[model samples]
Target: MSGQAARNVLWIMCDQLRWDYLSCYGHPRLRTPNIDRLAAEGVRFDNAFVQGPVCGPSRMSYYTGRYVTSHGAVWNFVPMSVGEMTLGDYLRPLGVRVAVAGKTHIEADRTGMQRLGIDPASAAGVLAAEGGFEPYDRDDGIWPPGFSDESHRYTQYLRKQGYGGANPWHDHANSALGASGEILSGWNMRYAGLPARVDEADAETPYMTRRAIEFIEQSGEQPWVLHLSYIKPHWPYVAPAPYHAMYSIDDVLAAKRVPRELENAHPVLQGFRQAEVSRNFSCDHVRETVVPTYMGLIKQVDDQLGVLFDYLRRSGRDQDTMVIFCSDHGDYLGDHYLGEKELFHDCVTKVPLIIRLPGAGARRGAVESRLVEAIDLVPTILDAMGADIPDHILEGRSLLPLLRGAQPAGWRPAVFSENNYAFRDFVREPLGRPADGCHTIMVRDHEWKYVHFEGLRPQLFNLRADPEEFDDLGADPAHAPIRERYQTMLFDWLRNRKIHPTVSHAAMTEWTRKEESAGIHIGRW
Candidate 1:
């Protein structure tokens, strides 16, 4: 193994990309050669899971090296507390500049910032507002007709490209041209089979790839971390011509579901099952039409990644840069009779994680089965760059040691995920639960997956026996001991979570030592 330090980190994140969609992870049809190349040259983690299933909370966990519970940004559009320290805040002090090229899904803590006397337009305030990243170009990638904002860089770029409309994103980029030249908006799932009007080069994936390349070319010799986040393979599932027609219904895999799952579903699960997205996806025609388009979007992203990887090797950046490929969370794609994520199923909670360490390492091409979480990435990046991971603030363990061919002592036995569904209509209307009582926690170990919902019946699955999670033993009296064991584990995990971010373990130790030396222990006397 080479002793050379990593000079830069290329953190590539894809939105709503399932772990099983890529060929590297054994997708039978959707071949992702570039990502497969990464897996072949690096370590592939088979048991990685997100701390949250939604974009905002999951990404917050990734950026801050903390759980969703710790950050308190439990759902989308929910602002994290202003005092939360992120990867950029930790890395910048160590001379590693952090920048983002695409969507972060981070909403600013405006009130918190204002109360702290920070002007929103100021540089310090901007960094705080963007979840501690220097935004090269930030776009969340969903722009419907009435919801379109012309101020968005992508929208402006589309307008410049002769996509004349009030909302170019919805008109051209996300829409298709019919036989009579009428516009077919991608907002409707029925139109998902049509090719987008925009060219492949001008699409969102390629646009973000170009931005990433520009940032890399402009970063002259400075050690940096560039988060090239791609908002693709998400909703409004439309791809450009070549990619759009790449796959057909035959290429789409069978949806993993069963009639048994619907027989006696848990109350919270029933609430999610009642969602429009879930209901629509449950139809055979919907899955048959939409899934192929979803595959096309994923194929487009893989092609763009091929372009990006080629640029890295050509520029000689591959020699000294660590390239990490991962997603925030997986999309259900009609799995488990669900469409979008926001559940504890493996299809939604588990995600793809491949880390290509710079130079050489002993563990190349290895497959790690240990339970890892999204929060571990920041610590891993900090570890690679020789920076201190603040123990009080960052709770996740670094994966650098594992990359170096050794396992860390006391590795966690299970991974945890959480969700706050109070914002959804199903929770409020159908479930009749209070907003504050809509919280749910999932604990998944080697054999059993346990979910504890607030004021609702628990859900349990024996992964060893029922790997597909079709059987629910939550109400079975025979599984009482297993549920109790996992419940205790969850309680212990919550009790040990780091709450005081301002106080470090080292600082507390030093304070105790000083007090002992000064003979200031009032209780001892």
Candidate 2:
């Protein structure tokens, strides 16, 4: 051990990597020894969930320690409103420098920046716009012709490497070359079998890993929080050499589904399955080609994790740095006949949460099965850095007690997740329901999972008996009591989401006592 307290944080998040794909998570074929090592040494949370199922909103929840509703950026490409306190806002006050590299999926709050008279192009404004993380290198990973509509450092690097096409991101990292020398872009799911036109090291995963290592090595005289976000395992499912051919179709696990999920499916599920994007993975041909490539991209990530962990240890930072590994959300990958992450299912909601605190052999290798959410990470990071948690700003509780092998009383009975599918174009006119009526809320406990769509029949699964979620018991007469219980739970959960406080209760009480001094009588009003 470095004999110092945990003064630094290495927050690593991978895009769209599912929890079950790791061998430590019980996958038989996928061997992620590097991530497994982190699990072996750190505390692993078995039931952590993301607040949203997609990229931008999920990342917003993670960075702000708040729910999607509280953050108000409920979908992709939407900027989180400025003045919504972020980890940077919380940590920087205590002298912790939070530096970020790789993707944040953040769209700058142009309106707020303008209103506040902050220059959007300035470094300070950029950091504030991106959840307050100082950029070691800010690469949103979506370049030219993608969601971001901009060029990134990775694209520039590709140009320097003589892959000088007009769209290097597509040609080098996201596309494959045809025998006729045509470019088969990986964006098309059918072309996933093709390998990217780059070497393993030049790939997005390795490039980001190298940049994170550089940031750590360049740190000077300050405790820092480095958000090392990786954009692989979430994509145009092609991987570079070695990783592309690392896994075969035989290694792909059989998609978990029962014929009954399609029979009398909830309107929400039916709508998702019929969407243009979801239809691609409905058949065997696409799944057979795409799933293997997805697995390979994950393998590449695992290999890079091995690299980063080794570097941390070699630099003696491993003993003093708190290492956290998680994902924004999981990909469905044909689960429930759905390809992308939408609708409420364990396939899309549940993600891996592993944390290795500083110092060796301190509650190492313990697993906590309690319900935790992605929103809890910011508070936990703040706690680990010895900073006071600003409870009024963050909606999550810290995991420090659990990390020390102590379970606090009054722990939550269930975890909650939500999706606002109402605004999506596919569901705009199909269901004839109000836009708000297309939203869904998920409440999951140890034994049961309930999903309630705004204006449709709810779906329920007794996870104790059917862990794979094959059958829906929402409409069963015998399960009415169970359904009602969870329904009430969801209602209360929404009705009682923590109200952001302008002043603490004690402060309010103290001020009320001096109301007469200020010429305002409390009760008379």
- Tell me, by lDDT, which candidate is best: 1
lDDT of 1 by residue, 66-167 (tens): 998899999999999999999999988777779998889999999999999999999999999999999878888755667777668888888888888767
Clashes of 1: 0
Q: Candidate 2: misplaced stretches above 4 Å?
A: 1-5, 143-151, 514-525
TM-score of every candidate: 0.97, 0.95
lDDT of 2 by residue, 104-173 (tens): 8887888998999999788778787777988777766554454422346787777777776777777788
Kindly give the stretch of ten consecutive residues in candidate 1 with the minimal lDDT sum.
1-10
Error of 1 at 65 (Å): 0.7
**Candidate 2: Cα lDDT at 59:** 93
Predicted structure 1: lDDT:
0.89
